[model samples]
Target chain A: MKHNPYAALPATVENIIVETSNITTFTFRPEEPIPFKAGQFVELSIPGFGEAPFTPSSSPAVNDVMDITIMRVGAVTERIHALSKGDTVGIRGPLGQPYPLDKFKGKEILIVGGGVGLAPLRALFFALAEEMDHYKKIILRYGARSPGDIVYRNDVATAWGKPKVDLMLSVDKGDEGWKGNIGVVTTILEKNKLSINIQNSVAVVCGPPIMMKFATIKLLERGYAPENIYLSMEKNMSCGIGKCGHCRIGPYYACKDGPVFTYDRIKDEPRIWD
Target chain B: MAKQLKQGCTINGVIEFLTTGCRVYALSQTDSNYHLTSDEKWESDRHMLGPHRPVEPLKSILFPPRQGVGRLLEDAPHSSPKPAAVIGVKNCDLASLKIHDYVFRDTEPKDPYYIDLRNNTLIISCDCSRPCDVCFCTAVGDQPFPESGFDINISPLPNNQYVLESGSEKGKKALDSCSDLLEEASQDAMKARDTARKAVYKTVEEQAAVKGLDGNKNYQNAVTGSIESHLWERFAEDCVECGACNFVCCTCHCFLLADGRSATGTSERVKQWDSCLYKNFARVAGGANPRKYRAERLYNRFDKKFNFFKKVLNIYACDGCGRCIEACTGKIDIRDVLKEALDEA
Candidate 1:
């Protein structure tokens, strides 16, 4: 019998910190910190229950303590919700390609996020924040189905108040106390004064497949190069590694080559938006 | 002592030597087609040699179907060791084994059981006497005989003698241990091996009539638009997603991890074979299948073959072993499907 590497890892869960209504953040430290690039995801499991892949909501720089924000829309999430701090679960990886933050050096970066897609972008956000002086500018346009669906709302507020980061929030259906814009994430981009130069600007977009399509088209219309638009793809990935045939879009493994890919690299693949 | 008639060892002598203690699996001819089994009663005059290069290759005997991948499960009882020898291994399967070696035998370390099985087993390869209609080893620049990655490679020789060559150190040892049956070969015996191999090579070349189709640069394109095309419905319309094609595949290495409680009441993780053809292969827990349509599921098979497999491993996933066509209850031919895809372009 072959000794599987993933099963050998401690299936011990650290603590389940419920971050929001639809989301629970799992905080667990692997015996060895999985040194990974931001935007990569790990296969989180509740031994004998089920497993799912999720990007670490925490920064990549924080190797010891890793946080994975999961939405309560599936079996694994429901099991994860039943747990509290110090419950044991299994975690495998820090898998897949990370954000290309190196490409954004000395360039103005625009992060367009919708719903729980903000989890991965948040890693990139803090990574950039640590080296704030190196970047020219950082702008974030975030939206969800409602104001409640938005994650890291308070973190975005602090980052916005820091003066170095410009942040905008929106919702599809605004409630009575809503003072911010009431529109899609695309509308927020159109309303903003975004300078999209082909040479020195990158827009990292992640959302539902429909939002990703329109947001990518909108970014291209605003002078962003096809190669400059990075989209974090959310597909059903079981392994979070190249071995599993799932999460494959053409020549690339969404888990390994990318959950993050430039539009130019994968534009020719069929049904990619879906 | 049993009489040894050479030109490839006498069929009886080889079987007699193999059945000592080792597990010997060979092709047994039933009424119509040949099946591989160890049941001595079912054994026929049919040799271990494979005639049709089925799309279902031989990767499964070594790699588990769907098993625990990265998860470490509590150790299960190691399967009882039975030293074995499988004969009539082909060239395309041999080539794919090299790719498998690279994947599993990483310097950083990987697949301990896979490495052990490959290391321990004695692989006896023989020359292909005839070529299947879908056989294209020559087109891919592969020979019909076992050239590399074999233990003992046997070439049919004239005058009832087999030209036996030691392919690996294990083969050398295996041959050395069988000193009573072995002898110093003359130049004529070597010449006989060359003639027999060339005859098979010529047959393979004639069979692979689709010129310039060997090195498929269009594989990426075939995989890219495969999902959107009607070809999936056309080819896989009758496919039941039975997973036979994947199970017998030489390179389909996807697996699933399961946790089971031991008789000792301790939980253990077990890795088992997985097939992409299954309905739930890509389904998430909430029932949102990104590839819900049959077309998308069928298309992923090709994508894994041409796109994902090639990009990561730098080798074609399909080794030109025609096992899938042979195993398909639907009679869907992969060669025809691939050719149609390339032609429609």
Candidate 2:
């Protein structure tokens, strides 16, 4: 029988983690292991509701279970937020292109994520942590709306803040008990005393469209080549393959050609921020 | 070998002969236009066999408006589909079918449902002896007659007989089975068929030239360059968002899949036709819509037809059939849009 690309594999929710009031992480053990790269995405479906594309938040090295971090936003996501352990759901793919970790070797990797966009970067961080010795430096500059919006707090505070890995955290606003830097994530770039070798450094950015637009400008102003900066693009996608034209951005189909594309490759396309 | 029916044979005789073995679908005349109907008897004096394309494109018969992609149970019984023969297919619709074949069957992981329907059906194409005012197949590098991709091609002669030619082995077999109803074509009939085909091409070419839609310029480059053109906003001003143009288009095959559950706890994923002109076509889960404005959506529809599909599939998604022009409630003519966007620019 021919494989139906739209058919979802039966999966059982193995675990659930509440990362924030609106964001939750659901772990599922599929009928088969969906081996994927750290930056790829999957279509998670709640059967009768419909399917929505999400990037896995857990390490790709962990094959037995997959973790998808979702924020309660629309109809499909509201249903996903209500899902608990032992509930049945469906998974379609480990779709789209992954980050080029091979190209990042022996170079300083600058990973910037804001809000729930940090989920895919977390997966990349875990993958890089496994091979920490392969690179000169690994830096993560993450920001969220507030301190309560910070995800993977324990890992960010301890595991990712080792001597070799420079971890910087900020928020748009702070509570009374908060003592960290209070500003948008880009402010950390201005406040940091560390200098990055622009010739040997590559930046990966994922966030809200506005954040991405300004962060890309900051990276370019810091002397990073357009080709050296990668951005994860999201659009309304169906048929995770290229058949459905929903995710199309100019000549590129975000589902097939990319959810991850270098800045230089798509700089000419219109309305990237929209 | 080319075959011919007698000089006085009516369209009803042909329909009866074609429907003998299996179901036959043909164009039946309606008040405004021709609609596909399965009624065997030719009830209307105004009904035509083959001169013009129908109001509905052939894609509706092959890939239905709504179809089941997945069932709740693994072992659900699927009924065997009845083999069908569709007659009066115009060359523009055939060209669109070629594009659809590249998308659904030629690509990786072929769609089983579309493949099943395609394999079970026989295509009977007919020549366009009369080109409509809106028809512009000549502008898109397509002829008013079928060049390929047909089971049987029927060319109408001057005296009402048809010169039937076979394009595939299946067509040859069908022709052979109906030998008793047909006769060997005469040289006079062949000459008349050639004259009629040439006349139709001339008419289409003259019409296209008058409208400045001769396909001379590089449409792909012009459309790609016009991303921010003010013309799109003007077009959006009159568009009602009824999606009638998309519904009547020959190659607008975008679809949305949803899972519907029954009270018995069984669910099926149903795929339904979707239009990019709709407001929510590109709206994502988190309310980020790339093509949010009606102007942007209008621009996207033309871009997909003229630019993106050509880049990916190496063929324009549109066949210049003009059904969209006929179906548009606002009377938005795509030929005029192309001329204004590509030629006038």
Candidate 3:
């Protein structure tokens, strides 16, 4: 029998966590365990509705259960948000290039995420936590629209906290009760605010396209080498195996060569920010 | 390497040989163009292979326009019929299998759907006698006739026969099964076919040069450098996003998956032809569309064919089939765009 790259395995929605008004975290239990690296994504199916590509928010360590943090943005996502617990859905993946964990060993790791883009980072967060002693430090600078838009609010500190981890949170518009800074995420990357060794630190960024573009420039300004900076180049990876031809960034497919490419690798590629 | 000639060969004889266990399709003359279809009754000699490729792309055969690529909820037994023999395939379409193979089969986790059909299908190519007005194969480092890459090539001779040459092991085996329909080729016939191929090549080269579409000029440099140029905006003015150029070009292999049902009415996913020319081709789930402007999409088409593929595979994706020039109702000529881009640089 020919191997069908598009074949989806059965995965039941085990739980749902409403992260925000628009974003939700879905925990699915696959019939077969899917082992994946941190930054790789999966194509979650809604049976009759169709499928959408999403990065897993759950730990790569856990194989049977997977958490996908998704926001209601389109037809497939709209139907995905409507899926209740115990609903069966088809899933295909562990696709695309994962974060370069081997390269980050013995170095400081700075994770920058915006809005729902923190989903794939959460997976990386867990993977790095498992080997927290391997790296020098882990710093996360995350921002959202407002206090209400913050994801994993219930246990971000408990789950992401470590001895060497420095976590910073911010919002574009803060409420009266919001004691944190009220500014964009790039503002947090200022000279006085961040105290990482520029040569020792590597930055991994994921977020909206505009946020990513600005964050990359900020990281560059902070003396982060283009090779030291990794970007999650999320295009419309229509076919997760790179056959669909939608996620082409220059000659590379985001589905195959990346979705986790270093800034230096794709700096010359055409319209990357787009 | 199996070259043979049939003294009294007919198109029906070729069709009859191919129709034993597989479905055979040949181009049926439709006005000045041709449509590839299985004919119940072919006209006396079926000489309507046409001077160039059909308006309908060859990709529509192997990688179907629409297919139910289902991930069945329930375990179901699957079966697919094996073979199809497509006749009178032009060199442009034949050469384009390189692009399709690279995208669908040469890459990792190969597309089972595309590979299945492509492997099962047999190509019976023919030497083109004349070039169409839209054709510019010589410009893109190609010839009117297929030098290689065909299973079997039929070059028409003056004696109302054809010299059949097998270019693949499959063609050699296929010829063995149908040896009764063929005769040994004379050295004179082989020389005649070679002479005819060269004559058409010269004519095509002269025609392409006249339009300024023929050259060894670096399309990669021109197209990649002109990303910020107003050339795209100017050309996009004449463009209506009909996607006829994408559909007609054999190299355009982009696709989109949608929801659909199979014949059993069971739930399934449908993967169909998609175009970069489409407004939302690069749009994600979010309201963000990278190629929002028509000009961006137009520029992207050239960038992929000229810059992207050239940098990666060292081959321009365009075969100069000129189907796009014919298919465009907006009358946006690709040759004119390339010429202008080269001139600007």
TM-score of each: 0.86, 0.93, 0.96
Which prediction has more favorable TM-score, 1 or 2? Answer: 2
Model 2 chain B poorest ten-residue lDDT run = B39-48
Q: After the best TM-score superposition of candidate 2, give how far the Cα of residue A93 lies from its true spot, in angstroms.
A: 1.2
Q: Per-residue CA lDDT of candidate 2, range A69-116, in tens? A: 888999889888888789888888888888889999999999999999
Q: Please report the interface RMSD of model 1 to 1 decimal.
A: 3.9
Q: Stretches of candidate 1 above 4 Å error?
A: A1-4, A11-15, A191-198, B1-33, B38-57, B66-84, B106-109, B130-141, B176-180, B201-229, B258-266, B283-290, B306-315
Whole-model Cα lDDT per candidate? 0.70, 0.83, 0.84
Better of 1 and 2 by lDDT: 2
How does chain A of candidate 1 score by TM-score against the true chain A? 0.92
What is candidate 1's lDDT per residue for B10-110, written digit by digit as tens? 64565456445656655655564555555332133645555533233556556655443333333445553466666666677777786677656662236
Better of 2 and 3 by lDDT: 3
lDDT of 2: 0.83
Model 2, B1-345: lDDT tens per residue?
Answer: 888985566545765565566666788766647777764333335345656898889999888888888763243345546888788899999999876787688876577778878888888889997877789888888889986899988898775678888899988888887777788888988899889889999899889888787866567776767776888888888899999988889998888877777687777777788899999998887778888889888888888888878887888888888989888888888887787788434
User: Which residues of candidate 3, in runs, are more than 4 Å off?
Assistant: B6-11, B39-48, B75-77, B262-265
lDDT per residue (tens digit) for residues B269-339 in model 3: 76788989989899887867778899999998998999888887878898888999998979999989988
Clashing pairs in 2: none
* Docking quality (DockQ) for each candidate: 0.33, 0.54, 0.69
